[model samples]
Target chain A: MIRIANGQGFWGDSVDAPGRLVEEGPLDYLTLDYLAEVTMSIMQKLRRRDPAAGYATDFVDLVKTLLPRLVEKNIRVVANAGGVNPQSCRAALRAVARAAGFGGLKIGVVSGDDIFDRLGEILDAGCPLANMEDGRPLSEVSERVLSANVYLSSYPIAEALAGGAQIVLTGRSTDPGLVLGPMIHEFGWERQDWDRLAGGTVAGHIVECGAQCSGGNFTRWWEVEGWDHLGYPVVEADPDGSFIVTKHEGTGGMVTEETIAEQLVYEMGNPRRYVTPDVVADFTSVHLERCGPDRVRVSGARGAPPTDTYKVSISYLDGFKAVGQVTIAGPHAIAKARVCAEALWGRLRRAGFTYQETLTELVGLDSCHGTIPQPPSHLNEVVLRVGVKDRDRAKVDRFGKEIAPLVTSGPPGVTGFAGGRPKATEVVSFWPALIPKELVRTTVTVEKAAG
Target chain B: MRRVPLSRIAHARSGDKGTGSNVGLIAADDRGYEILLARATAEKVKAHFGGIVRGVVERYEAPNLRALNFILHDSLGGGGSASLRTDAQGKTHALALLMMEIEIPDDYQTPYPEGSPSKGPPAEGLSAPRRKSR
Candidate 1:
């Protein structure tokens, strides 16, 4: 059995997790997933400002901290920290490794998932790159597209591992691909090994969110212990496509059939068909059993061939938006908050400024669930949040200016407006499309740290 | 028949998918699973959410895990960064769903008994503790 553990759930996850995962247990491979749907667009914006600033900078510091332990323990690292630019990330890692005196460190770089430059060529070749949600053609938002990347399979990651790199960095790969890649490399699983691929993919999904599968977000929060030092999830995967989901000994968090069940259905669409680039896993067929303390054995995961097309994540600057909030205190807080919101909108309209979309929420009351039955008759305070979105940046900016004036002009008890006027920020919206699998190609290269 | 909140028999977790949200409701036991399968229909769930959800609701069964997955379409204002609502990702939708009340047989036994710590005091205006059959 190979021991693989996930440390970082997302880009802004716990900073101490990666090092703690290495120090706490026996791990053969460590995987970190950093990319989310909108992350690539942010990276693209960063790259446009400074050529070498696109990738996850936190990853470089993390590797610097864990490099010694990783080399001593012979642990291989796989991560999608190379957001939009793996070459620059590789260079940064090479510099860090060399400075840290691990000159012989081999880092693999995976590219070709990014198709931003080739969008016109591909679209001209008959692939419309239409939006999957509304079936809108790309021509509607072509000029505003910020980042375009295909969700690559685990094959390139596995190839990098086989090339003898201690660390593999990729761009726009699936979250499960980071874990499944090591399984493919260590067990030598072929591309068509549907059952085994499905098994690894299932394991990947469980631990990808760090402690969410363990105890961090369990529904029975009262039953879980050791919140200060919760153990992240680890997988003891076998070649037969079955795995054990457990954490380190004497660590916090409980891993039972129920916790595993909750995580199994997290962010899930269809239980019968969990689609990834490698295989379409049948989540409904998965069997979970409490084999031991804090250990759940998962088996019977079935799979079928993947689709002919690969889903592409594209982000564009939809518009500009600004949100501002103020606190209303004293009795009748909810009523006063509503009045404040109305007066702000009323002032904006009188100034000859109207936005494309506007939202007003009394955050403390029914903002979340939308007017649940029998709300409390009285409250001490309520936060009045107002926002506006528009194609014209000036209109959104004007809406932001209207929020702070409510502190002195609008209501009796308005405060908490110390932050001043909210600035209009670009709204980077997600656009999911599909491209034929054959149209995308991936390349992997291994480079040694320059001493 | 007696009505109790679904939280007494099941637990849930939810997350967003573009403009929609997926809630995974898992029963506490085999009997609870049957209760959910019978009472937590897609139509009922849609009605329970009321104006909170704008589009259709679809439910899928996962018998292996004693769980039912419900997908609420067009629920978020726009979802992700595009959404203007406070709960852009629908993280609290699971607890909102657990607030739903379902009718059970008068003689039925629950894993979380009445007055237990897990089953907190009944919400205001609920019928006082009594056993009856419809």
Candidate 2:
């Protein structure tokens, strides 16, 4: 039996949590998730200037902080911190390990998800890279794409583990696959055990979001206590592929059936058809019970065959957008804010500065109005936020410039528009599509740094 | 298609028959779901059935938990004993029909994001309970 613990759901999670998870509990493997859709683009921008800057730098510092304890305790680490730049991530991790006096650590890197250099080649080879959302081909924004990654599964990670890697770093893998890979390694589970494989996938999903399953975002949250120091979830896996999801004893968070249930429904779409690269688990087949304090036994999860295709997250340049807000105060503030926003758009439209998508929101007035069914009607102040997105940056910039003018010309109560115009920023849009698993190949390499 | 809750499904009693398993369907959410599950679990179910299930397709409804169930024939590759994924479409169909039978609770609500294609729909039905944010 092996105990696997996940310390991060995404980049920018609690810095001390991973170290705390290892120090406070007994764990064989530790995993962290540190990448997101827009994060790739941000890292790409960072990499353009510095060759060693594309990966998750936060993870390097984290490793340096936890290396001593990890080596002392014998806990293996796996993470997808190698965003867009695996080699750099490897180099950085090695540097950290060496600096921490751990010179013989072998770091494994999983690569080949990056298709940035081959975008035109793929398109030229008759792969349109069609947008699954609108069915538009990749030719639409091939030139504007910052990053394109095919989400890989846990197999490559298992290979890394077999290769004697003390730490495994990956780029653009399914979040759940990180935890599932460790389980496959610990249990010696075969690839054909779809039932057991699906069980691991279910466990991954339950704890993928870090503290979320423990008490980070429960709807019945008031029932929980000591959330100020809520502990993240840790999984204890047995040889038979069964596991118990729990947290450190005396931790602040609550792990009950309701907490797990709420986490299960946090961002759910279809209850019965939960899709992952490993298997499509039947959420209904899952059973959760509070066996003891800080421990919940999750078992009996049923799974079906996995889909033939994997979802690809492609973020491309949609357009440019800029938003500017001005606070309107005093009597008739709401009306004044409305007129100010309209006057800016009217002037921009008259100046031939049109946008593909334009929006105006009265933040203090009715931001969550329509959805909540009852939005406040009376308000003494309102913040007028006007934004525009278009292929033309000048047009979006023009829309931004029009907001501050309301203070002097359009509305009497306009104030707090001292920042001038909001800068025109590139709009990143998501494209969800599927590619046959066979078409993509992931490779893993174990590298050691030199002095 | 039937709909059931996790709470209701937990109370369900599962029976085994010499490695072959039998459990009544209490509720199912949609027809496509059973298809999804069958695609993932055809081999395992076949192993449990001790081979292929080739007779009639049986169906039952659990309004309380909202599920359905079906039983298949000798579909397991090794004479209803081995669990392999290379099953025939008929066997896959029978397995898809079988998943609809698990009983779900009346209050079974979805517990995670379903990774849908559409973007910008604030995940509904969550009321933010005020507590110190962690």
Candidate 3:
């Protein structure tokens, strides 16, 4: 059996979690998932500004905090903190390790997931890279493409582990692939071990959100015992293709079957077929039971081979947008908020700037659900959140300047406008497309850096 | 039949993928699951979301877990980073769908005997994550 813990859920997740995870208990592998679909474009912009700024620098800090324990406990790390640039991330970590006087650590860099440079060549080969939803081809928006990366599988990562890499860093690898790769290397599971691969994938999903499986954001928030002290999730994997999801015993959070079940459905599309880079997991075949306190025994996951294509996340320059909000209070707060929203837009229209899309919502009443839910007739206060998106950045900037004027110009109850003005920011739009698996080649290179 | 909010019998979690959003709803019991499969069709969900969702709604059943997954395409204006809305990542979409009222048998009650926490707390503090949405 092997123990794997997911400490960092996202890039800006609570700091000290990863170091505390290694310091708290015995752990074999520490996996951190830092990339989302649109993260590539942001990282691309950062890379353009500064050559070494693409990766999540927060990850480097976390590694520095845990450097002593990681070497002492022989705990390995697998993280997709590379973002758009894996080599620079690895080089940065190497510098950190070298400065700390640990020269025996080996960092395995898994790159080639980034296909931005080769997108044109691939397109010329007759693949349109059509948008999965709109059916429009990528060629329509190729001129604006900023970043295009193929979602990598576990094979290259597994190879890195087999080559004795103490830490693995990847770019654009699937979240579950981080766990599955280490499992394949340790258990020596074959590529055709579909059930085992599926089991690992399910285990990864359980703990991918950190505390989500360990009592945070649960449906029954009241029933959770420790609200202040929450434990992150850890997976205990057996060679027989089953895993037990649990947290450290004295930790803050509870890990019952119900808690784990809640995370299983989070952000899920088709329950029966959860597609990862490695295999297509059948989540319907999953079986969960409460083995003990803060422990959920998970088994019976089935799977099949993956599809012939890899889903590529292609981001482009969509436009610019700016959002501003003002608190409207008193007897007719909702009505006053509505007036403020219209007045802001009316002012923008009169300024000869028509936006591609404009959104206006009352924060307290209909912001969350839009028109789906009905609010009460009277409300004490409402925040008028208004925003506009347009191809022209100047137009969005003009809309931003109009929000604060409501305090003196339009609504009687408008008062709480604090921020100077919401500046127009570039929109890094996501375009999901598929690519033939054979078109992209994944490579892993391991280099020793720290002791 | 009697009218009741869908939250009386189900729990939901919503998230986004590109321009699409998915709301996963799990029933309290098998009886509630049966009610959902019978009433919460794709058409009903699409209609419930109305203009907020620009595309079609697709439903997938997970019988073992007593859950239904609804994928609403073109739900966000574009998606994270690209959408101008406050809830760009579609974080509170579950609460939106919970407001949907459904008709159920008058005699059939929820499995829970006491207070209904499943009704969900009011939607508060919806913000898009700058670094990551998942």
* TM-scores vs. true structure, each candidate: 0.96, 0.75, 0.94
Summarize candidate 3's per-residue lDDT along A1-451 as a digit string, tens digits: 9999999888888786787788777799999999877778889999999987898888888888788889889999999999999999988899999989878789999988899999989999999999987899898899999999999998898899888888999999988888888898889988789999999999988888889889887766657876666788889998767999988767787998767877888889888889987899999899888888888899999989989999999999988888888999887888888888778878777888788898888887877677676666777788888888888999888888998899999768888899789999988887899999999988889989953
Q: Superposing all C-alpha atoms, what RMSD in Å does each candidate have to the true structure?
A: 4.2, 13.9, 5.0
Worst 10 residues of 2 chain A by lDDT: A366-375
lDDT string for model 1 (A183-278, tens) is 998899987889899999999999999999999778767679899889999999999889999999988999999888998999999999999999
Give interface RMSD (Å), model 3: 2.2
Query: What interface RMSD do all candidates show, one decimal each?
Result: 2.1, 19.8, 2.2
Which stretches of candidate 3 lie above 4 Å from their native place? Answer: B104-109, B113-134
- Ten contiguous residues minimizing lDDT sum, candidate 1 chain A: A370-379
Instruction: Report every candidate's CA lDDT.
Output: 0.90, 0.67, 0.85
Q: Over 4 Å off in model 2, which ranges?
A: A124-126, A369-371, A410-413, A418-420, B1-134
Give fnat for candidate 2. Answer: 0.00
Residue B124 in candidate 2 has what lDDT? Answer: 47
Model 3, DockQ value? 0.45
Best-to-worst ranking by DockQ = 1, 3, 2
Query: Arrange candidates by TM-score, highest first: which order?
Result: 1, 3, 2
Query: Model 3: which residue pairs collide?
Result: A102-A450, A102-A451, A103-A450, A103-A451, A104-A450, A104-A451, A105-A450
Poorest stretch of ten by lDDT in candidate 3 chain B:
B125-134
Q: Per-residue lDDT for B17-111 in model 2, tens only?
A: 11122333332244323433343243443443332343322233222233333333322211111121122122223223333333333454433
